[model samples]
Target: MNGDNRIHLVRDEIRRVSACDHATLDAVAELLGTREINVLAGRLGMVAAHMASRAGIAEGMPPPGTFPGAGNERIDLAAQWNAVTVAGWFVRKKLTAWWWHDVLFDGVLVTYELVKAFVTAVVDDDPSHITRLTLRLRALSAGRLVIEVHDSPENAHLISAADNLISPQVEHVAHHCGRHEHQGRTVLWCELARPELSRWI
Candidate 1:
């Protein structure tokens, strides 16, 4: 998909994760200007995989170190798995919010949900609630892909199994956001290197 469409799909996944029921889904789908259930589900799947990976990694179930094969197929499969995990976390939350259906807690829960989505999309590895995610960008040869994810003080105890996947020359920063107050809001950030935004001559 094109960047714009891919971005919309990402946003739709977020909305789908936020809704409570069929009617709510319909409303959100309408707001997003699409009725394709498969597309919505694709987005959701992506999210689920990430959330699952996050939880699993945190609990000691590790993600695969090597993707088995080389070339585009392997890359596509990784992307597919990543997308599904990322999407699943949100959908699971949607189901819960549907069950509880509380308005007062909606804002807080939903914000955490969004934060999860944001981190999953960019972290280049499993989601660990124990750590705050921040981002950094690095320069490499044109058309190359490099991603690195690490754990900080807040998440040091919960080791990520994806560290082995990191390529050389890809820099990462790990620091704890440790239950600290930031301008009246709790903050967690990961220093991520944005390879997608790199330029080549």
Candidate 2:
């Protein structure tokens, strides 16, 4: 992707994150009706009765390497729905997904924070060297979802930098949450369940 396009995504992501972190029902709902917001929401595996969209290649420029890459990349930016973001949407829309609110809320939040903290502590400015931070969410099943934040194949060894990050959060939840190796990618992951999560939430 060109530097201009990457910057645009980062700016948009910053805006979306701010919006999600401080969302109001009336303010966000009207925007939800738009084709753009609906498509963005749908990209993250969120679809209401009136809207259902699948995840696809973002913005068309597939970054760089085996994944998205750019040498002139200024900063990483992407709009992703964590459990907290998802729960917020569900609550605002009054959706019937109890599992989203009850299960993954703090679980994903903690994991997300832990991994980000690792990046900050280890990389200082971030391993991306001012690239976009993109998180991918996947539902392994009705009761489990995996959150992945990838740096780059070039910084593959940095994956082990998170080796010690999980214990702090694990002491609190400990529901199959940790770092994982899948194929060639390294990911920090957390799982959420309805009944099991009640003990923590």
Candidate 3:
């Protein structure tokens, strides 16, 4: 069969098995090929993110947090979740549209969950303590995507707790995970390997 037909078949199968048990999905993904599954997952992630954005806007919520230079800055659980979800969609879309041609589909999902856990931990630990949160994404040299979450330097303990909360989750989808201090800001980061891009070229 031609490449396009094969891709269509694979995507249909992926959709069919997406709601099945994890083992079933894994088996089908293995049979269909990881690259094809990753592409499908990326597309699905974008769809999910778009739905989430529309839902938030429809509910009359403000856009996550103020962007840099917006004069007002605040970060809370709702804002953090919104930012990470939107960022995941943007990153995945950019990969599909640009030179990368590969997306960290599983990684994006894990990062969203991890970000939620991180935000919850902080709020539970001290509801009023965290005032600033920043998330940054960058492509690493070795075909990896790095997501860096930054917050107040004094909240080192909260960062550590978040690291512990998502350590196992991060391991499943990411190659590296750590916490550090950068220019006096506390940072938590995870590096996920991008799927091979040769097929799209």
Candidate 4:
């Protein structure tokens, strides 16, 4: 790009723009290739995670206490569950709706099927729907896994204990389905009680 073709900075932009000249921009572009540019911010190109780390943050996350609930411990179910080929494939296909599991649950036949049914009911397993599910071992409960399905606001209206949605009346397993306040959102919660779950562990 020619110097004449470069964008002219306005007064406000000049203030917000990081102190860097064309040579610096050219060096950044050459060193990083396509990754380094924030044209709108008028700043030097920096990888997001690296920038966060430099700011005393971790992997694009603000430091603890930077936000209202940043201190709470939250596990990334995807890191483990998505490693399973089938689960990863499913996530990739939908792009929005995702089925997940935490370290506690082995996600066997019954558990996996039930969780899938609950999520599919709300999102119909469609890629456009933003519904997602997470399964974790219920605290202070023996052989019980809690499945929380967080629905998109637009689709939460479809959450139900309908027979077609969740086979709650089944003979094999007795489960509880209800809504609970989780982080200010009404989460579709289900408890899967399987005493034999400990066998896998």
Candidate 5:
């Protein structure tokens, strides 16, 4: 088949397989008329490469070294429910299914855990006070993931103490962890470099 026709066929098959409840490597291999899992993996990797290229082309420029203000994107959660709900929403909206499959599946779980810790710290500080929780996700230049948890000025002391407790829970997964202040907000940040995702190119 022609190049365009082949791409169209592959895309259609991908969409079909993605809709399946058990969309595993074996299932994809069956749908694509291939029995070799390695071949299927290589093909999918090529597809991801092409998608990245297309994105750069569509932007009429080379792929950006980093997303604009990526390390500084913040979401403010004003209440406990808001923290949990927003964290779930961010996962669903910001991450693609392909991303979950190719990399960072466990990373999402870690992020959720941290989100819970952040929310709990704020709520425990002063249940009656209106808590403001800020969450930030950034992709560093070295391809590491950095998550920042920020609290309002009123809860600064509580957040600092809470971060000390939270750090140990996440230190096994995070390469670096620390606390600081940003624009008057108390911030706790963690940087992670997953072996599987570190070679993304």
Candidate 6:
């Protein structure tokens, strides 16, 4: 990606983060004036790396290796999600003035935060959640970024009630949506488009 593409991705991410953070669209508009896309993108990327490192340390996992090189980028989706997840937590508890009300009404943000907190707490307890966490990121982008995470049956009987719990919101994500179960793993995935941006792939 060129500088322009980077800027576009960063700006879109910032807008999305702003949304997930419960910043009113108006508040994001306010930010547009003072923040340059490149600077914000750099900060976003750094924030993600920092949070991912913290999550890894909390889990007692070894830190990831440095990037092979900048051009070798393959979309560190886990870290991206980590960044957004941590941001969601911060936005809800630290940044927003209406945290209490928004937590109830902002379903997308709520679910995202739930997944983050759940994943963080589980990773803190055991290492197994790392695999599921990686899988969740892949499933998120496999076809179109449509993805879901629920508790395993052993941990929580989530699969049986997934549809009733999430269908109303996720129905539009894919025509063929369902759960996939493995020995100790379960995931609900769908196809979702990356939100269109003016630049980059």
What is the C-alpha lDDT profile of model 4 across 1-201, one tens digit per residue?
555445444434544544768887677667553433444222322222222323322232112121121111112232122323444333233222222333123333333444455555554535464544443322212223344334345444554432344344322443444444433444444444444422211
lDDT order, best first, reads 5, 3, 2, 6, 4, 1
lDDT of each: 0.33, 0.43, 0.55, 0.37, 0.58, 0.40
Query: In candidate 2, which residue ranges exceed 4 Å CA deviation?
Result: 1-99, 125-128, 182-184, 196-201
Candidate 2 global TM-score: 0.41
Q: Indicate the residue-level lDDT of 149 in model 5.
A: 65
Regions more than 4 Å wrong, model 6: 1-135, 139-143, 150-163, 195-201
Higher-scoring candidate on TM-score, 3 or 4: 3
Runs in model 5 with CA error above 4 Å? 1-72, 97-103, 167-169, 181-185, 196-201
Residue 176, candidate 2: C-alpha displacement in angstroms: 0.4
Q: Once model 1 is optimally superposed onto the true structure by TM-score, how far is the C-alpha of residue 185 displaced, in angstroms?
A: 43
TM-score of each model, paired residue for residue = 0.24, 0.41, 0.47, 0.32, 0.52, 0.28
Candidate 6 C-alpha lDDT tens digits along 1-201: 799999999879756775665456457657675446566665566556433433332332223333122111111123223644543443344313422332222424434543554355445454453323332322121112223454544434333333333344444543334455555454544333333434341
Predicted structure 4: lDDT: 0.37
Tens-digit per-residue lDDT, 40-154, candidate 3: 7766664444333232323322223221221221133233446567656655665455455454566466557556656766677777554445655555432455566666555
Would you give me the overall lDDT of model 6?
0.40
* Ranking of all candidate structures by their TM-score, best first: 5, 3, 2, 4, 6, 1
Candidate scoring better on TM-score of 1 and 3:
3
Clashes of each: 33, 11, 0, 0, 0, 2
Q: Given candidate 2, what's the lDDT at residue 66?
A: 17
Off by over 4 Å in 3: 1-84, 93-101, 128-130, 161-163, 181-185, 196-201
Instruction: Kindly state the number of residue pairs that clash in model 1.
Output: 33
Candidate with better lDDT, 2 vs 4: 2
The whole-model C-alpha lDDT of candidate 3 against the native structure comes to 0.55
The number of the candidate with the highest TM-score is 5
